[model samples]
Target: MTKSNNSATLNLQYGGGFRMSSVIPVIRKFNRFYTNVLGLLDQHLLETDFSLSEARVLFEIGHTDRCTAKMLIDKLRLDAGYLSRILKRFEEQDLIYRIQSDEDRRLYYLRLTDRGRDALAKLDARSDDQIRLMIGHLPEQAQRNIAKNMAAIENALSDDPQIRQEVRIRCDLKPGDVGSLIHLHGWIYAKECGYNHVFESYVCQTFVDFFKHYSPDKDRFWFAEAGDEIVGAIAIVGHPDRRAQLRWFIVHPEYRGLGLGKRLLQESLQYSKEKGFRRVFLETTEDQKTAIAMYERAGFRKIAEHENHLWGVHHIEQTYELQLP
Candidate 1:
């Protein structure tokens, strides 16, 4: 949490041979797209003779209270000789001045001159203007979606855990909500269970069936949102005999231990009760140990099961029932 330890370090394990997922090409494509976007914006960096790196140095020097060359070296991880040259240039240009530290005369602190402040202000304005122009035509909601997705990508790849807080649940579907959930299901299951196209096809078919049997008043689909992104979901669909079927229950791998699964399960059960359902049931796989454990702890009894090879794996199909008073 402290700035000193904010940088992330990842640990990876490599096998002698491993099969890369089909998603790698798509990820590389997005990487190219994002790289281009940044390249476009970078065309308008600091207008002075300073390169972008030099401008960054100036900004950090201006902001850090007790800026020193050692701090800059550690923070930026730049070659000390190269940074000393940049600082020398700034001094020659009258943009920054150094003062001797009172306690340690050998160490000098950096400060921006009046001209340096003006230059920094101009650089900041230009950066903001470029971003505004880039996303100006997008609707507000679309802009938020872009921002949220970008943050999600950053968080997924980050070694440090994302800022934690209570996740929020919304019980309504938006335009692209179903599509995102389907994609999450496909991606997560493929990674976790070795599931392939057959599983995705089954999920698509379920969505189609859901549309055909949809009843708004008696059914609920809850999305667990955290950090402005959909991370988990569960649903309770009404059936005859005062029963409800829980469907499409999932929690993102990155957010599994945050109580999101339990919260979503609680919400689904509560909603089924509110809808006057006397019994609640769900179908899951034996491989879903965490979810099954939660169900058992919540008083769900396994009523039926069969063995079969589906979703690219040999797993048991289980049906769990919970009697609701």
Candidate 2:
């Protein structure tokens, strides 16, 4: 059966039935196992005098730019009184200091003291060492599986029903951005789609042409980021006659099968529409059957085709065009 191209149509079943009722114990079991593995039940985390909650407070203080008691309360969802006691403990130990906000005297901002930084540093190192010791003996693949599963759990359990939180989308480009995207295209296509260096060169040349006539107001590119890495990309480059070309649509194999491709395509099409492009079109080889199918589902029709072997592959290059509303 053919699945819907729109990700919103892919529903995850939910209920309070026997199957759902049975899942709680299994989830709790995994939670217990993980907590034990991390030694969270220990009176002191990483053999430090601080409890897990206290260590987490310190870690949050160290990482946050605008540290505040209220922010911590909101983030940790801790009782005001409980957080106040923790703050008092930190102050007594000279781990953190507070300064009154200039605009609001009652609003105090938390800052880590030298002692606090040192303690946090030790806690960070110890936590890293602990995880290393736990996973060090496992094979590299096993280690990756653990990390991947962890991400999957977070994405699945998020309060938002949409899968969008699993990836970040941005239209802004900075220095070295194009090079990184081009490199991603080169490596990902080479590894997964059986494309070669010649294809990479073609990608480079396309970017070169793109930059030569780049316009921020009319042309736009979207990047899909997952955990600090760019996993997918799509671009809409404006042309004459109210037309726009979609280009550089690719997603990393590790992050595929997660609706990122559909989302990226939708973003590009939306941008093209906003840019007043009456027609949106893309050039792709027939080997990209899956992407072609998605385009077809999204109302794109094959406008032209040509036999091309320029990218070290003998394939029919197809031009798919979609009329915008």
Candidate 3:
């Protein structure tokens, strides 16, 4: 009998009344790729004594000076025992050190040694060079296509309810990320809110120009990323009058209706209050009924109205103000 080369062979039977299991074959193929081709399974088998898992733990420790075991478990999703073994192996190598928490002796904190830091840095450099070599072979459009497809797959996976429950919002706001927030907001308004490109373009330009004249220390931006993809964002810029101007609030269409937008708004307001702002204000079109309502519910009151040319006509721009407690 001859072995079949047809793609449809995956669905055919190799035995009596029993179809061949495709899963095992696929897993084996992946194992071969990761072990032989990618050289990930035991790439450092002779060069280094650490397993892949141990190397990963060292990498995480090198990135942050102080991290608790719980933080590492949460970030990597590794089983407690598995992570413990890896930690122990690194400790034996004197590559990492752990200390018991003074407050809770049961809790352990981990940090990398100088040797571990140097090792992790070399690993990062090697990984970067490897990716650059592989991606360099692809054309610009092909690379973009890979990025788009990967993003779509990631967003789809994050939509799972089980995964959503584990997602956490990050509070740190960095400069230049405000531009990303502005882009997201404009894109959401144009796509989900059914506005035209004119409104989005104008709003984006307004945000860019506003950030240029204003210092970022006086301004704040926040973003929510689920496994490295930006799902939502918001920003508050300081007005010359000492008021916090809320702007560029947006949640991706995939993440909307999940209360992420409300969360971002609440956090932004809280950050503004902490920064010594007495009052907060924002402007939105009358058509943004849901957003306007949310602002009102959050103690913001409509103070004035104006015309917005970006709306392509005379659109009512409602300004909402909230007094910080």
Winner by TM-score: 1
- CA shift of 135, model 3, Å: 11
Candidate 3 C-alpha lDDT tens digits along 10-92 = 44533233444655675576567646745643464325566666667777787755687777788778999998888877788
Model 1 CA deviation exceeding 4 Å by range: 1-130, 133-146, 157-168, 226-229
What are the clashing pairs of model 3?
none
Worst window of 10 by summed lDDT in candidate 2: 6-15
lDDT of 1 by residue, 91-178 (tens): 9989999999999989899999999999889888887888899998999998888888877776676554435444678988888888
TM-score for candidate 2: 0.55
Candidate 2 runs further than 4 Å off: 1-165
* Candidate scoring better on lDDT of 2 and 3: 2
For lDDT, the strongest prediction is 1
Runs off by more than 4 Å, candidate 3: 1-151, 154-159, 165-168, 171-179
lDDT of 2 by residue, 1-325 (tens): 3445322222322333336655675677678878876674343383778888898899999998879988888878889999999999999999999988899988888999999999999988888877787789999988987887786786656644454346788989977778888899888777656788998898889988888999998899898886556778898999999999999898877567778899899889887887789999999888888899999999999989999776666779899999999
Total backbone clashes of candidate 3, pairs 3 or more residues apart or in separate chains: 0
Error of 2 at 153 (Å): 13
